[model samples]
Target: MMTNEINKTTGLIHNEGNFVGSAMLFPFNGKLFAITAGHNLYGKKFTDVPNLDNLTVSDHTKITHPIRCILGDSAFAKSHDIVLLELDCKTEISNFLPIRFCTIPRNPKHSLMFRGKYKNTEDPVTHRAITYTSTTTQSEHKFLCQIEKSLLMNHNYSSGSDWLGGWSGSALFIDNHKELICAGVMIEIPNKGNDGQLLFVNTLPLKDLGFESDIINAENLDFDKALNAASLAAIIDSFDEKTIREWEENNKNSEQLKFLNRKLNEIYPPDNIVKNKNKIIKQLLAGKAYLTTELSKNEQIFKQYNSAYKVYNLDSKEFYVNTKAEALTQLSGIKSSYEEYLIGNLGDDLPTADIKLLAIYGVSEWIADCSLDFLKYE
Candidate 1:
């Protein structure tokens, strides 16, 4: 989405009686408010507090609204550059942008997009760039992301024009083929003539600081919904007698082939549904699933996942795994973990860097090596 198109959800934030930066309007706890960089509200480098009475945000129509309160941790202490301001008055929900929670893309080649108002310009500008993640700090609450210049350099504008001062607190968004999901928020920008890498804080840390998890959960649902829709669309688009014949030849013993054929025929039956292909595709493009209900529940939503093999916990209804382990190994780990939880031994040690690393990266490498060694020629 472009800057001019998203003005309804974007606004200028006035800090301590000055135009400090821009902020994005987001839904927080069933209400709407402006969220901006903590530095903007707490003063440069977080040295002084801004005048709360003078703190304000202006919507697309330039109507100013007073801030009710500021929430979240200190920028320097928590390493979270976010400041969630509670609104003193309610704004029209239609005028604000929809809030979407999403994880930062780990793929370096992934194209990311964000829009922000430039200090020198009247309109907000859109940017499309690839991301480079810098080293994670010890806090793990914040990480620096470098917004590399767009591969398509057809434009004449400078990189600073798209990601400089007055852009802090602007939402960095990515289209998930469903909706515009926010991945991060702008915190700092490189000086002019420097490699214009925009730095921002991922919004995930805010959850630990007491922001509701519901928004993130909804984002996951939207993501899954979009993926399913896209997959179904591709299958429908590629369906044909020749394709069915090829599938039959390739998967003669596959049990799922019959089910796939039945579903395809049901959607594009040679008679009635074929005529409505255009309309169906339009809905699909709008992120509507062909199926009325969810296909399945994905238990593994946490980014702290490390496993390819998941064994469900019958007692807690949770899924846990460390790698592609045999059924016996998985069961043993589950039993130990559950027992620890029962005896209150598990809750004592909060998650540390080692746990986080293990969860995120897994023991897959070691497991693979060991399995190869033990099962060789077996």
Candidate 2:
């Protein structure tokens, strides 16, 4: 799960009709931003800012455009190359992995984990190692991170080339207790040398970027908002008005509605969901075609939904049975169906099934899990 989360955080940056390097989705100030090494966009020069129209980033699942770019302004920022691109707030960025900005100084004793995409691949990869030492230049603005060995050894590289060229903008993280604590961004391999040492601009300079007070500690990071956004995004992507309306009408007075309403309020405050409900519904309905095409590559997701639909119905009261005998029977039948699906015995039972069926069933399951009041009756 940690690996998957890391993969979602990093993405490929493309501009000028070519792949540049990699970038990570950074959440700050109740908004999302993309961060990468400054050199990726400015090249060797620090002052060169390119045309912003063509710059875009992709996680391979979706593409997002930057609304504005924020360059590093302080001496600390220029010494340690860094750039932040403010992403469009309305874009679906809910799938990004939650990360905490490290406010405290990095400790060399802790092992480091780096995640980024190679220039040739769409998916991101990871490298883990311990920092050998950290050096400070005379300018006192940057901290050079020297690792024990080459991170490129795990990859199949052609002989005679030892430079880590394609990983300029990768994110360096410290894995502490299953939480990803971002330490810095990989700026470059110093002088293109092959000494198995790399340079990272420590994250401490993020304080100079006007976000010092907002720097979240790994322990205090609240993931509830992100999780709520993810759930709402899924519903928007696979939206079916009839199914949702029916479910809402039936569960209006139930505890499920109360819990869901609370989550909705938390995500979009001041009753945004209520005020823009019709507009959002219309937009989601119109986007169905585009979303389907974009998600067609992951057919397994649809298959899982279809299998679950066959196992249970959203409107069925049998799923909320009061007796142990009835619960066991339902569980046994669901297990049997799942086993059959796993072995490919149930081939295309509902090939043309609406993906919304899965959404309804998923919501029902979520509500049932949250309110297990029927268990007391048994």
Please, what is the TM-score per model?
A: 0.52, 0.50
Worst 10 residues of 1 by lDDT: 367-376
lDDT of 1 by residue, 258-279 (tens): 3333333433435653333333
User: What is candidate 2's lDDT per residue for 208-250, written digit by digit as tens?
Assistant: 6765534544223222223223323444555566745655577
For all candidates in order, the CA lDDT equals 0.52, 0.54
TM-score of candidate 1 versus the correct structure, residues matched by position: 0.52
Q: Highest lDDT, which number?
A: 2
Query: Which regions of candidate 2 deviate over 4 angstroms?
Result: 1-4, 73-77, 103-106, 138-141, 146-150, 153-163, 191-193, 213-378
